[model samples]
Structure formats: C-alpha cells, structure tokens
Target: MAPQVDITVFPGNIVNNEFAATTTTRHAINPSTGEALPEVPVSTKDDVDVAVAHARTAFKTWSKVPFAERARLLLAFANAIEENREQLERLLVLEQGKPLGLAKMEFDMGIQWLRTFATMEVKDEVLDDNEDRIITQTFPPLGVCCGIVPWNWPVLLGLGKIGPALITGNTIIIKPSPFTPYCDLKLGEIGMKIFPEGVLQVLSGGDDLGPMLTEHPGIDKISFTGSSDTGKLVMQSCSKTLKRVTLELGGNDPAIICEDADFSVTVPKVATMAFLNSGQICMLVKRVYVHESIYDKFRDAIVEFTKTVVKTGDGFEDGVLVGPLQNSMQYEKVKDMYADIKHQGYKMALEGHAMTNSKGFFITPSIIDNPPEDSRIVVEEPFGPVIPLLKWSDEDDVIERANSLKMGLGASVWSKDLDRADRMARELSAGSVWINSHFDVAPNVPFGGHKWSGIGSEWGMTGLKGYCNSRSIWKWKKVM
Candidate 1:
C-alpha cells in the first residue's frame, strides 16, 4: 500500500531554522489535475533580505568549521532525507507531476549526490616542496551562495547545488521555481532540524524573487539551472555585483544512430531519452540523426515501442510512463510547437493520444517522420513529448548538423562498434558524450555545457571547486 501523504501540510520559506510566512502567497498547481495543491509563500524583497542576512551570519561560523565535522553533518542530513523518503516522493509527484517511481528515483539520485559530496574534499596541492621554499595551492569557500532550482527534477537539481555548496563550507539560500516549490520548502523544513540556523534555507516566490536574490550584494555566488535566455538574464544581473555565477542552461542535444546500431536495443533507449521527464530535461536528446540505411527501421521501431510502452496521464496512476507538463506556460509553449508542426505539414509517424479531453495539461507524445533539417520542430527545442527523426547519410554532415545548434549540453552515439562510437563521440561538441547510453551522470563526474547550454561545471572536483576560491601559499625556510 502507498503512504497517505498530505502535501498541503508543508511549510513556507525557512530562515534561521524557522518558518517565515509572507503576507502574499501563491498556490502551486497540480499539473496532473489542473488544480491548485496548496499555498506557497510569495517572498518579497524583505524576505530575500532576511534570508541573505541570515546566510551571511551563518557563513561566518560555517566557513571556520572543520571539514570533517561538516562532512559528518552532511551525512546526517542525507540520513534524515532517507528517513522521510516516502513522504518526499509523494510530495514530488503531487507538485512536480512526475510518476511516483520517477519521484523515488529523483530522491535516490539526490541522496546519493549528498552522500558523495560528503565524502569529497578539495585537498591542497603542493606545487613546490624544496629545501629553500614551499608553495601550495588551496581552495577556500566563497561566502553566501544562492542556488536557483528549476521546475523539472527539483529535488535532484536542488540537491545538486545544495550538497556541493554546503560541503564546501558555504552558507546557501535556495530559491525553487514557483511552479514546483513544495518539495524544496519541505527540504528546508527538514534541514532546519539537522543543520544550524541559516546554514541552509529555501525561499519560495514568484518571478521577482529571483532578481531580488541574484542582484543582492549579500550573495557572493549564483548557481542557476534554467533556460538559456533566462540564464543570460541571470548573468547580466550578477554582473552588476560581479557575483560568481554557474549557469546550467538549455540543450538541444542530439542522438546519432549509426548504421551499425541495433534497432532492437537502440530504438527503445533513444525514445526513452527523447520523451523522459515529458521531454523537459535540459540534457535530454531533442533530435535524432539516424543513418540513412537504418533510418526507416529505427523510426518504425521507436514508434511501435512508444505506442506499446509509453503511457501518459496523472503521474500517480499506476504504470504511467509520462506526466503532464508541470505548468501552464510550458504546456502552452509545447502546444504552440505542435500547432507549428501541423502548419508545416510534417509527417508524424506516431501521435500517441489527444489531450483535448484531458483535464490536466497533457500533450500527445509525437514523432516527426524525417522532417526537413531547418523545420521548426527540428531547429528549436520543443521541450515536450515531441521529437524529430532526421535522416543522415554522410557522417560529417550529420556531425555538423548535430553540433550546429548553439546549445550543447550533452549528446550520444548509438553504435555497436566501440572504436567508431568513441571516435564520433569525441568529435561532438558537448560537455558529456555517451557511446551507448544517455543521461548517465554521477557525483564524481563533471557535467556542464560547452556552449550556450551553460557555463561552469557541476558535480565532481571541478564542480566542487566552483564553490570555492583558489589561494596560493608561499613560505621560505630562510628569509628569501
């Protein structure tokens, strides 16, 4: 039996280990039902000031705490999250509109990230050790950090920033997207019990809240995950104060199906990547370039696989493989793209189901049958359950087309020939390239974008170093 979790009972903004309610509030909509779940506090400039001030105060002591103790506490925090795993998973489904199983997976990924970050340490490097002189390079934490999380994969992405920021001895304030803020607020509520006052906080609000926090002088750094256009805005805002910024933005990642690829195995995987998270993930494969010889077979197989396996409706429904778009803005955007595809008269191999009768913001999972290279569906990211299957004969032309897009977060190659796949993967312009797999990320591996997709990396030593400032120490044995 499933747990009877009531998502409405969650708290609001958390500052200094306490709930900070606001006079103005907004309701978080349940994308599955097209109804409001519960009221989340709409933070104002004063709320931002309070949270930042608390974070600033906490950083003073947090930065001085020993690394071992910080790691221990972080482990304890991860344990606490495990204790409330079921509740968090249920809440995630209600607010984020992902299947309950996917919600659980998100928690699992988040918990692993926290645990891995706890074990990671940025050690000092000895550049020169000699009789006459010794020089070393060390990483020191940057002060108060603000993490702005997106609607999709809120918990996983939220923890992605939180784990590294706190483990590196920096105090952080998280601002979750208003569309799906419940889990983040609940996380903040849970954190208060384990962490010291102001060590970790979450503030929920509408659009204005982001600029309030990003432009504030108190915030030393901004770690943002959102669209490329919005990421550009964030960069501009941070430049006013010259705040350190890490932006993980959009992606139109491509998946190349080589001639040697097995359609039986590759089709299912490519379809899954294209439609996962309702096609909302930044790193999801948005375009597919199939070798001309196998293009027709791969397209037919994928269409059949999607029809047989992909189920959509409310996320809580059993065996639901996809869910509604998390908010109205995105739902409308995807609908517009669908209309455009129709207006262009592109052949749709598989148009799963009509959303007209559905109550929630649902769109039919669709596939374009080898559309024109410059078609809207092929050129722009639909960010919904729609994908373009393009035919490619020349390897160089396909590679060029794949890398032509401005956004390059991730890409994948499907080929049984390991050497061929490796050579092709190396040529693709992306932060993470896979031979046979997609969306394979780990805490120890660095992940980021190569172009407009994002700036700076997340996870691993490189990501961990992003939270700190490098310092070099030079000492002389004798007055040199």
Candidate 2:
C-alpha cells in the first residue's frame, strides 16, 4: 500500500542510537501531487557536532572490533533492511518522486550493496620479508566518515557510503539531502538495532549541514554525490581539514551508436537509460552520437520507442513509467532550458509536454534533434527527460567528440562488433565505460569519476580503503 503523504515525522540527528529533534525543520513535498509530506528536523551546526562527537567516540571501539564480527553485523543489518524493504521503499517514493518500482529497486540494490561490502575483504601485504627485517601493511580505520548523499537515489547512494565506512571500521554520519532525507534518516534509525550506539548516525538539515560536515575538525573523510559546481565547493571546503574526499559529481555522458547497432534492441535500452528517473541520474545517456549512415533510422527508432514506453504520472499509479521530478529547483532549471531550445528553434524529435495547470513538476520526454554542438542542451547537463542526438561518421571523430566533454563519470558504446566495441571502451576517458550498456552499476565494481566528475572512488576494495588509512608495520630482529 502507498504510504500517506503525511506519514510520521522524523527527528534530527541520530546520535548515540537515538533521535534528536531540532528547533528548525524542513518540509518534504511529494512532487507527484505537490503535497507536503512529513517534515524532517533541520540539524544545526550544534547537531552536527553532536553526531560527529558520537561517531568519534564510537570509532574507538568500532575500529577495534574483530573484522569477522563487524562483517557479520553489517550482513545482519542488510538482511534486516531486506525484511523491511516494502515499507522503506514506500517512504523513499513519497519523498524522492521516483516511481514505486524504481524506489523499490533502490532499496533492493542498497541491500545487496550492503551485503557485498560486508563480504569484501582486502589482504595485508608484506612490504618486505627478509631474515633481518619484516615489514607489512595494514588497513586501519580513519576516525570518522561523513557521507553527503544526493536526492535522486538516496537509498542506494547513502548505503554506498555506509557499507564501506562501517565495513572498514569507521563510524559514519550520513547527511542526506534535505530534499529527500526520510529514507536515509530511517536507515540510521534501523541501523541502531544492528550497530553499536554512535556507529551509525544521520543528520538531516538545511544549508548549514553541508558546511559543518566538510569544515569541522572531527570529520576524517567525506563522500559527496552532486553537481560539479557543488563538488568544487566541497573540495575547496575539505581542503582546510585535508580530509579524504570522494566525489561522484555530474556527467554529460555520451553513447556512441555504431553503424551496425541493432536498433530493435538498442532503442528501448537507450530510451530507458536516457529517461530513467526522468534522466536525473548522474550517468544517464545525455548525448547520443549515431553513425551518420544510420542516424535517421536510430533517431526514428528512439522516438517510436519513447512513444510506446514513456508514461509520466504520479509515482503510485499503475503503468506509470516516469514520475514528476523530485524538486522545484531542478524543475525550473529544465523548464528554462526548454524555453531556450524553443527560442533558438532547435528541431525537436519529440516535443515536450507538461501537466495541464497542475502544480506537479512533471515534464514529458524531450528529444532534441541535432542541436548545434555549442548549444546549451548539448554542452551543459539539463538533468531532465531531455536528450540530444548528434551524427558521427567516423569512429575516430566520434571518439574524440565523446571524450571532449569535461565530465567523465561514465560513457557507453553500442555495437555488435565485439572487437570494435572492446577497443572503443578502452579509449573512453570516463571512469566507467560500458559496451551495449549504460548506468549498469554493481556493488563489487569500483565506481567513480575522472576529470571534473570526481576525485577518488567508492564500492570496491578501493572504496573500502577510502575509509581507512594504510599503516606499515615493521619489525627488525637483532642478529641472533
């Protein structure tokens, strides 16, 4: 059953395994119906301090717990989430505006991710093994980890940080985006049963929360997922503390549609990635470079496929594939971009449509045809259900064009030729490149960005190390 719009309210910082409500609060709205959902407390700087202090105190013991015990508890927590998946997923949908199916996927993926991290282990290395001296490396926990989660897929992204942080023996304070704080905060609440007090915490708040987490002395590391502009600010802020930072920022990812591509299979697959979550995903295929010979065919196939599969409505409604955007700030941004497209007379493959006088921030799928290379729709990320298809004649030229963008989070190349696709994938500049796929992330693989997209990574052996500092221990025996 769908949860009530006015479901139970949530408190502020979860410090020491208890909810602490603050004086200030922020109201979360349901984008599908424009109704205000539960109001979550706004954690102030003081609240952040409390959470950080508790995390620091917890680290003393958490970092000392046997790895087997920590992994067992984390796996137990993941199982618990699976048991409570339905209710948690409903909570995510009410706040995040993703369709009920997508929200449930987020919860399910989050649980799998937690288990993956729980099972992940890295072996210590012997730097040197000689008769006279022995030196080895060990992974020791960083004091405290602060995760700043974005709104689009908060459940999956939030747990991305939590799993790695906890498994690596660091206590974490999760600061969920005020736009969609409910599910993440609830995760913190759920974690209390499995984790020790102060091991897991969440601070929901307004503008002040981010700066507090980045600038504070207590936070040892930070993992952020958001816009490139905001990521720069986070990097700048973390510089003062010299804390380890991992940022998964914005992307203008391009997908190369090779001449021999299978349109029947490719069109629907690309359509799903291009417009999934209304194209709010960081790795969505924002640009398409179709071979000139097959450009028209590919474009028409996509348009036809979109017409058949695309349906925008309230998240809970049956047969609704797309839902209203999660917030107004993003809605206005995309709305303005569409205005510019119309003013410039760009040839749109399928014109956009909006809700009729409804307060919902709903926008139908938009496919702009062959916008100029320099146009805003082509250059900047609109982060909406809007995509631009361009023509590419030569693989070399298309490769250059695709790698031209500054954001290199992810990219895809579609082709039946395995050799060609494999070679192209190697040359792509993005951190993750897929052949015949886009935005296909798993818990075991390391996910991150290159260039302006991000620094460092998450969700692998590397990610586990992100939450820890490597220590080299040495022993020298006297000549016996």
Candidate 3:
C-alpha cells in the first residue's frame, strides 16, 4: 500500500464561511513520485453559483469595512500563512514538484506581497477644490472576482490574486489548476476562518469548472494566469456577461548577450534564469541571441555551468537542484518536443534523453547549439527544460528575430556596455525588459505583457485599480 497522506483540507467547498459538500471529488497525485496523495472535492456548476452568490452578498458588507481594518485582516492572514509554513510548503512541493528552496521562496514571496499590499494606500484623489465646487476621484471595488490560478506557481499566483483583490475590497473566488490544487484549497481553508464568509473562496476541479465560473452573470471580473490560447477563451466566455478580465498569458522570452558581457558572470546567471523551475516560468529565458564574436565562448561557459548546476530528483531529497515536471499533461508535451529535437539531429550541450527511471515526470535540462532559426524548438515554446542558443553578428538582425513572435511578454539584454544594453532593451518587443537581470518582480511595480502575453496590469497602483472602478465624485455649494 502507498504511504498515507493528509486529506483533512477537503470534504466540501466553503460557502458562507462553512463547508458545503459536493457529492463528487478527485484525488491529487504527487508529481515527483506519481503516487496518489489526497482526495479533494470536485466542485460543480451549482457550487459556482453558491460561491458567487455568497460573494455578491458579502461584498455589500465587505465593501463598507474601513480600509485600514481590511488591511489589518489581510496582514493577519499573511501571518497565519507563515505560521503554517511547514504544512503549506510540503503540499506545495508535493503537488508542484519544485525543489524545497523554491517552494519555500514562493510561499515567502506570497506572504511578503500580502504585507506590501497592506501598506499600500489608494487614497481618493482631489482633482479640484474651491469654495464653490469640489471634485474628487475614488476607486470603488469590482464585485465577485474569480482568480483562476495556474498549476506552475499556484501558491504565488493564487496569492497574487488574493492579496490585491481582498485588500482593495473585492471578494474573490479562486479556481486553482486541477493538477496543483492542494495548497490553494488549504489556503482557502485558512481564509475561511480569518475572512468574513464569501470574501475568499477556492474551488478545485477540472476543465469544465472554469467555463461555468466565467459565464456566471453574478461574477463581476476574472483574473487569470495561463496559456495564451486559454486566455483568449476566458475572454470569450466573460464577454457574454461583460465581466472585466485581467489575463497574464504565455511568453517566448529572449535573452540578448552582447559582445561586451562578462562570460564568467553572465553564463551561470543566464543558465539559472533559463532553467529555473525547469524552464516552466512564463518569463524564463526561452530564446538566446549571442553576438557571433562571443557566441562560442558563451555557449561553452553555459555548458560547463549547466553540468555543475543541475541535478534532477525529488524535491524533498538532498542535493537536488531541479525537480520533476509538475504533471503528466505537461510531461507528455515536453516528451514529444524532446523527441522531435533528437529526430531532427540537433546538438545537445548536455548529452541526455528524457528521464524515465523514477516513476516521476523528469527531463534533463537541454541546450541546443546553433540550430536553424526556423526550427520548432526555436520558434515554439517548449515550456520545459529545453532552450536554443543562436548566433548573430548584427544588432538589427537579432532584435528583429527576437520580436518576430506574436507574443511579447518579456525580454532581457546583457552587456557590460550600459548604453548598448539599454538601446537593445528598448527595441526588444516585450512588456518588461531587464537590462542585466530577469524575473524580478516587486509589489509596487506594474508587471504584465505587451502583445499576446496579458491584458491589463497587476501590482502597483495600476494593479489595485484593476480590481476597482474609478468613480468621479463632485460636490458643489449653492452661491446665495
């Protein structure tokens, strides 16, 4: 028999601050070991109605609570999450299959973000003031928000929606990815005790659940993180109800290495950035363009570093630099991509094949050397641990190639020459361009995409606004 695991987090969905059981439920599998972990409730269309109706009712009262008190409760929830860090971290690693360090960091980041929003003050702006008249701008909450969290970073992504939505007075219902729903459901369990009934909710199920929530007339908005294809569908679903939508979608990000970059500093940093989370991050460096003058040196340096840096295994084990792929759907996708690369006779910097021994979804971190620019691995997002290194001599040529995709999520420019890197970063067709660094996000900074990656923004004042509607207030005194 498989070793027993905890299942206390479920039995039913929480509605009106209490457990409401659904007859059906589903079990989660440990991505690293392929073992059944726990059975969680599979909520349904009726559950969506109950959740949204409760949220709509709660929003009436929640919107009236003092902003400062709301912030206090949010911070208190953050504290609660930290206090339960050990349990949350274990589930995160079990379902998500990221290393412990990464799992811990993601949870920590979520806590930190809640606190950041706690301090943020979105005060009413006084547009004009005089004896005869006064004008002010206020942002009122959007009611009944549904945050659809992706599997890759469920804790962080789920909290990314929770913190802002609640702090800004919008009640939230989170739909976590089926493959990684444990932590999110647990977070909902935590929220139930701390927040007023219906203020925060989590519903865990497969494909059909999303459409039900999105199409519900009671839902006011949706904040989603997933593939560009699904994002388009989310937009279509919400369109019928005219619900507001904020989407953070796919990325085929690029990293430009100018001739001036330091090989020692650049190689290892880029290697980590490229393969972190097994290259599942939407912002992870996908396509790399190196100046021909330093291309060979850069490629060799990266290969040496990759050998020393990566060791795939279970997240709980010691000395494991990377963990297994999060689920079988993504596992098969990466498997097919790797097979194609082999069949096409691409050169692998790290000689290996897809992993099979551990009963887990695992793949070796791979880098292709000088593949044709038109290759599938070069053009499509493998969304796994494979990347391509291409050479370019002309600045104009490389920039054009990088911007060729319909997606413009993120890009990076690396050079010891500050001016050249800045110029290159400016021209790169991406929403967030980093000069030397990659994937660093702050709560106070606005982050999103340009073309196909996202709609609207998250974080900063703009992020807070995304959850609200701007209402202009006017007061005038009669002159007698």
Instruction: Find the candidate with the highest TM-score and give its number.
Output: 1
Candidate 3 Cα RMSD after full superposition onto the native fold (Å)? 3.0
Q: What local lDDT does model 2 show for residue 26?
A: 74
Ranking by TM-score: 1, 2, 3
- What lDDT does the true structure give each of the candidates? 0.90, 0.88, 0.87
After superposition, the stretches of candidate 2 with alpha carbons farther than 4 Å from their true spots are 1-7, 477-480
Per-residue alpha-carbon lDDT of candidate 2 for residues 141-176, written as tens digits (9 for 90 to 100): 888999999999999999999999998889999999
Local accuracy of candidate 3 as per-residue lDDT tens digits, 5-88: 233456666677776777888887898889987778788888888888899999999988999999999988888888788878
Model 3 has how many clashing residue pairs? 0
Highest lDDT: which candidate? 1
lDDT tens string, model 1, 163-271? 9999999999999998999989888887888889999999999999999988999999999999999999999999999999999999999999999998777888888
**Count of backbone collisions within predicted model 2:** 0
Task: Name the weakest run of 10 consecutive residues (lDDT summed) in model 1.
Answer: 1-10
Q: Candidate 3: misplaced stretches above 4 Å?
A: 1-9, 130-132, 477-480
